[model samples]
Target: MATFFGEVVSVYSRAVEEDEEEEEEGEEDAEIRREVQKQREVHLNWRSEIAESIESSSDKTFQCSDLVIAVGQNASGFLSAFVLSTGNWDVVGTVTLWNERTKGPSQVTNTQLPEESRCVLYRQAACPSVVICQCTYYVAEDQLFQWTEKVLGSIQRRGLRVLVLSDCSVAEYKTSECITASPSPFLRTLKTSEYRDALRCPLMEQPNILTGLPAAVLSHCQVHRIPAVVYQCYSDVACPDSLTMEAYRPALSCLSSKLGKVDYNPSTEVLRKVVRVSEAQSNLYT
Candidate 1:
């Protein structure tokens, strides 16, 4: 090739041109991955009134004393059947997130009640400082740390106490005894050093560890020097059952005074309704 000034110029081979094109494509692929990660980021969406309140607050965060989180089917069902059934609580906010496992609405929808959403926040009218989060969504492993940070970051750390309720399979629990001899639907606790309160259940023994959102939350609290504890229920049932949900009753005994005196043991009708709803949702073969 020759320039307009008559100076000789060399033309690159097709191989070089193809290599340049490949480099450009790689850059484009990198940009796409970055955008996808941004989309998968965790987010907490508060109701209009709550948003305004937080904006008006001096700390720009929710003033919480006791933040109770119920994660998984049985744990959330326990809240639904016993505590939330009293109808003294109001939906204050929700968690909006997207990941590979999320199949429900990505954002809060007016058609569905807060309780029906994947992760919903509720506040007791009698005790505004006490908040309950019922999370039913599947939070992927990569997203757990982010989810914990976003959720706890929104609440004021001063005078904050966190309690996490979660359920797992009995098979996950480690014991030397026969599986049939071991108690099913039993509670085990894990707490941070900052947490000085007496636990209702026995501490989780060594050689056993926690994972998922509960572990993430506890780890965050431990590092931040926040008082937090998790009450994990190990159940044998593949589906949520009233017995499994009842296993968490003792865990909330300490919170009764703060949450107001409501019946911890809900009527059988309420239990049936809550269990039926969870069973319907989790029954893939039906």
Candidate 2:
């Protein structure tokens, strides 16, 4: 049978759906409500911690960050560049992304580098620090969660406000919502069914199929609760279960609360609100 995030996908998906259906079945079910309330408490509490840091920021500006615009190593880092731009909140940073198939797109640019060369990614300065990382779903699904967990964790500990937008995480998008029947083709003999059909699914034995990364990525950056949002563009049909625009707004509300009541949402007009999110983020540090 298929698995999800190291758990039995079929069973877990069905359970979640059933839980939702059961919720509709009896609106006044106190027990179910209590259980759900408890889960929400955990989720919201985590969000609260992130918001606290965002609210306490000293500056009053914001930044726009995008990562990994497309394939090819040269243009591959476009989204990363966007995510790293930290400037006036009123003018979010612009990130350009296009694929460089092979060699430098610019004649003056040298695609080859010395074998001994090495570079550092960050510097402590008045400007917002920039970090860029890229990976695909199939390439690094197993370590996806753990690696980002560390990166995000460190960024938060530094106290600088952060705006993180990963360019990829389609597998996560799929696994978070869909129910798979089997993880490995090796289990050909096993019966598979929709997640709605299964229960108490068995533990998965293979490495995570989807990078168990996005939720963890959100969790890490969100820990600081910096006034942040991600703009992800899907270049292919592989887009998974994207959170609805409606659902995303509420999360921003939760994040904005952390940014000291600034208008951190997209719909609000900053010109009238006069509360800048970028400057606000940087000053939160030091």
Candidate 3:
């Protein structure tokens, strides 16, 4: 049986086909289009929150920030290093991903680490915080959602922002319009010729898969009323393209703008400058 995500792929494939049979089913086409429209409306409503945040932030500067939890994926080391280098912001380390190719579990580790690691560590910081998920579209949506619900939701104060960073090659590109409502917005299914161009091996050797993880995770944030941002960089990761960091501007600004709005919870005391050594050092504190 196809899962909900799987059904999405099937429907997308059918929707894109140019076959005569599809034209014969005008009523069906209209129905599918309506469903897609509904999804788009939901996404637009969700994105409006981000746009509003951006607008609301244009007039002020933030005063309350000390900690940042950065999670990296394939380029964990590069991304983590970049974040840590910019300042002393706490990099909590990578996310632990399970159920990949049914190979059990794998940690999103630094490039220096093994392909899979048994122990994944994260640090606890007490201060105004933001979570950055860098190129983490491969992560399971349900897991990401649950983590957001627990971590971001648990913050007694209001200023927890989730920033998603993605790098895309030409082949991986999808219109922002198409991805706003899907799970793996950063990835698209490979075409036969494109697969041949990238890998000399037979196309059959590759998996016929597309990912909507980014959109799924973002949608989850929207559902929970969490402030989130996404930005994409272009490079050779998927295709040979000129590199630039321009995509980061909007995300950074969004973070800055929303920081002032974060409320302080005296009881939780996450806003404190100093955390107890026991609380700060323990990964289990969350």
Candidate 4:
């Protein structure tokens, strides 16, 4: 090809150039996705003794009879004040994972350090069959299924009964009546088909579905024929308060024997500390 001045000009195909750029970008995007997924993968870390027991066990799973899980601020606070304060429980394992909402280090170096951990497992010393999981971090939607599977899979399913306590905003509750007219902090129950025990509260109403980790655990239990129950507390408080924490008392009452001596009537001072800590955490702008 020659220009009007008899000088030849080399021509390049714009379409080919654009295609190469897109191909390179597509590969880069795929690599980014792979890295993100790897970071998001959930890992279950058990204590040395617990890991050894699991490995030596015939079933290769921890033998658990009662697994109680508290998911959210109010639920976890309730357990911290009433159940865990009993001083008969020991930290056994932890779940480590990273997500978009994760803050600070995701891997916990010391299981005893609760302040540094997001999800932790505690087992009763007197009754080893009973285990409690306190999860105070956000588990993204995509990670919920895997989180539930790994946590539940590690525990023996035979004769296992799971109890989950979770909290949601009162605004999320569906009702015809005014939400303020009804109780601000109340308990609604959901149970798997295999759970034949009497509920501590009314069943969750239709068209009002549950999401997040509690729902994920219940769904897994339902599918696996495991006896599981969830008590969801609807609270108006923006942060965890004593009232919201106390709303879960009835749910814990059903498992009183398994939980040992729980301080159902926690002292006012104890309650204040719980509420104060939550309020301090909530005070971001101040």
Predictions in order: lDDT: 0.86, 0.29, 0.35, 0.86
- Model 1 residue runs over 4 Å out of place are 1-26, 108-115
lDDT of 3 by residue, 166-263 (tens): 45453454344543443332222122111111321122113322234444445655665555443443333432111123223333434334343322
Residues 1-286, candidate 4: write the lDDT tens digits. 6788998755576568888999999999999999888778888888878888899999999998999999998998998888887767888888888887865355554333434466889987887888889998889998998899889998999999999999898889998777766677998989999999889898999778889999999999999999999999999887888888988888767668876678878889888988787677668896
Clashes of each: 0, 34, 5, 0
* TM-score of every model versus the real structure: 0.87, 0.27, 0.38, 0.87
CA RMSD (A), model 1: 6.4
Which ten contiguous residues of candidate 4 have the minimum total lDDT?
107-116
Q: Write the per-residue lDDT of candidate 2 for residues 137-203, one digit (tens) a residue.
A: 1213433444454334334343333333233322333334333442211110011121121212232
**In candidate 3, how many Å is residue 2 off?**
34
- Sort the candidates on lDDT, descending order: 1, 4, 3, 2
Best by lDDT: 1
RMSD of each: 6.4, 23.3, 19.4, 4.7
lDDT of 1 by residue, 1-286 (tens): 8888997755677568889999999999999989988778787888887887889999999998999999999999998887888758888888878888885545554334455577989998878999999998889887898898888988999999999999898889997778676579899999999999888989998778998999999999999999999999999888889999999989768678787665676899999998888888777797
Question: Candidate 3 vs candidate 4: which has greater TM-score?
Answer: 4
**Superposed Cα deviation of residue 88, candidate 3 (Å):** 3.0
Model 4, residue 30: what's the lDDT?
A: 100
Least accurate 10 contiguous residues by lDDT in model 1: 105-114
What count of clashes does model 4 give?
A: 0
Q: Where does model 3 exceed 4 Å of error?
A: 1-81, 89-94, 101-128, 133-137, 140-157, 174-211, 234-236, 239-250, 254-286
